[model samples]
Target: MTSTGTLSRAQGTALCVGAVLGTGVISMPALAADVAGPASLLAWLALIVLSAPLAGTFAALGARYPDGGGVSTYVRLAFGARAAAAVGWCFFFAVPLGAPAAAAFAGGYVADILGGGHTTMVGTFLVILGLVVTMNWFGLRISGRAQLWLTGTLAALLVVTVVAALPHARPANLTPFAPYGWAGVGAAAAVLVWGFAGWEAVSSLSGEYRDPRRDVPRATAAAVLVVGVLYLAVAAASVLVLGPALGDSPAPLADLLAAGVGGPVRVVTAVVAVLLTIGAVNAYLAGASRLGAALARDGALPARPVRTPRRSLMVVTAGSLVSVTLPISLHTSMLLVTGCFTLVYVLGTAAALKLLPPGWARRGAALAFVATLGLLVLNGRPALLSLVVAAAAVAYASRSTSPKIRIPSSSSAGSIAPKPNTNPVESLP
Candidate 1:
């Protein structure tokens, strides 16, 4: 009956949009189309459909629990402390890799428009990296507010892009669907998982909602519709309008924009890419920094650099810089990150099976669990990284926590405390 929250339903919906939409639409269409030709639409549709139950599962958990331990708490309650710690590590580390790949995708769009090649791309990455980091340092409430504006603009642009481009979509392009074979659809779906990552990330913010049970479902439903429609519109437009040239095109959205409403859309699309990247990176950082703080509190990491959100931000910033500088292909980095995200989803949905009341909710969780696990297998060898990171998390926990806790004397006899697996990625305030 009572409501107390700083975020409105609109803001909650906006945050969901920002987190789930991501920069995937900027480049994922062409990459996927290249793999499966017009058949890539299957991947798009499948994942979009899967998002409903996936997001629903999280929304149910968020509303039911309504705590800062957004996702990890559920895993802790369903499984155990170590399993929850693994969830925490998977997400806390996933964002560092995801951020750079997202920035680079936007950078590619800028490079296409400005004609500076890799230099332009690298510069764009640096600018966005610094920008989002600064935003998080100040607190993401500012960034979250901006997300409301960015999501609207981004959605408008997507609709306009699709509508304008639809006239140019040729039926001939779809004739030779499954160009690489039906297996390509699987590959494309695996790639598309990057776009659908933030469903659980929203759970991290459930505690910020005014009426968790009432508003969480409404906001989630709105976000699911918005993301599913916009993404499908963009992906279908890319394959139908761009046809075979999709694979070679560096900026699919800009190309689609040019084909329909021919103009200086490369520049406009570049702007879209930047805004998209900012919205996504800001959301992930906000979530990840808080997760790091919780891990420190829970004894998973050294208490010095992550005891506070600001310090945790530094850790994330440092890890991201290293991730960006490493000599890895954009394709490879994305797989690694999505692999981690899928692992988190597998864990999250499994937790839902236990936490949700019996009935359709539980049935949906079972389906989602299978779906995410299948996607993880599609990640191929890169998915192995998620398992490795998770193992490291468990190992770290085992080594870091002392078996005994001693009372602090009058001075400072602080002893190492036993770690509690609170499923901490959403564990932060």
Candidate 2:
């Protein structure tokens, strides 16, 4: 793997875009349409608008202190070991659930075209999990480059699909938009959380960028624009082109293409889904593996076999297997996965609010914190369970934070101090 500062802005942007796109783009349109009808488009727009401040908060922190540990590092800088461990736990545990959810969303598309049910889905999940783990094993430079290529191809196909489908969109479909009322909009927003999440993925790779300060924010900005337009276009097309049928569509993008091109292009959307899922899961595996290793080095957990990050990867793989057993569909699984990352966002944004100076930056962070918290609640009981996990992790970590085990100068990301510093927080690195 290349050392820190080796990645260019283009690579950084690819990481961000790949991380943000994923299963959500492929499946969320139908799910949100089911929840809020055409008004789901509003939920799509709202989250895209909110993504700016939320992404900026993490981007600002990454620019200041580039680290592989990402949001966990920012937490350590602001709140010390306990909170940091908890955020790390949230992220670490999220991978297993999110990976399976991502895999399943794409698998659903494949199953639809082939007719094999969960058996096909399980096979798809296993193949995807194995492929991404293997890709990540080679190292980030390869993975990041793969992301750039994957996203480039995914973006081109998506742009073509949206443009071709736009001619089929009818304004009449937008009428009776709020058929389910405003509450439905909120419900739709909760589902869209999966779609909007992923800004922090780039933060975890911040140190790898050629210039974190210059590249990370530029990457984030470019990703925001890319994801925002693509998502809104797809969401709008699903509503206006498919209308009531949008909610029931197993493969909305394919259906949209079929409407425009006069035949099913299951092959087209399915290919996009597979490529997007690979990039998304690969990016998460890379970030989570590094954060896991950093946690081990800092004594948040026990060390494992050699330099392979084998333990963390195994945990994620096993967790995905277990997740497959749950009696949930892709849409529900997305909500549960979104809850996990929303918890991470809440912590990171809260940390920024606490650590940043009293100014627009901090205010933006505060807004993000409140928005994420709202989304967290919308996630319902799943979010509460995540909080319980965090509380337990914090209590356990408190006992392990001995003076000698404190973060060392050589740690790749955020390091916990042995004792809390009473001086101004600016003294922290």
Q: Using lDDT, give the best candidate's number.
A: 1
Residue 32 accuracy (lDDT) in model 2: 91
Q: Give the alpha carbon lDDT tens digit for every residue of 352-403 in model 1.
A: 8987878777788889999999999999999999999999988987777622
Task: Give per-model TM-scores.
Answer: 0.91, 0.91
Each candidate's clash count: 2, 0
Candidate 2 minimal-lDDT segment of 10 residues: 420-429
Best by TM-score: 1
The true-structure Cα RMSD of candidate 1 reads: 5.9
Q: Candidate 1: what lDDT?
A: 0.81
Error of 2 at 125 (Å): 1.2
Candidate 2 on 31-50: residue-level lDDT in tens?
89898999999999999989
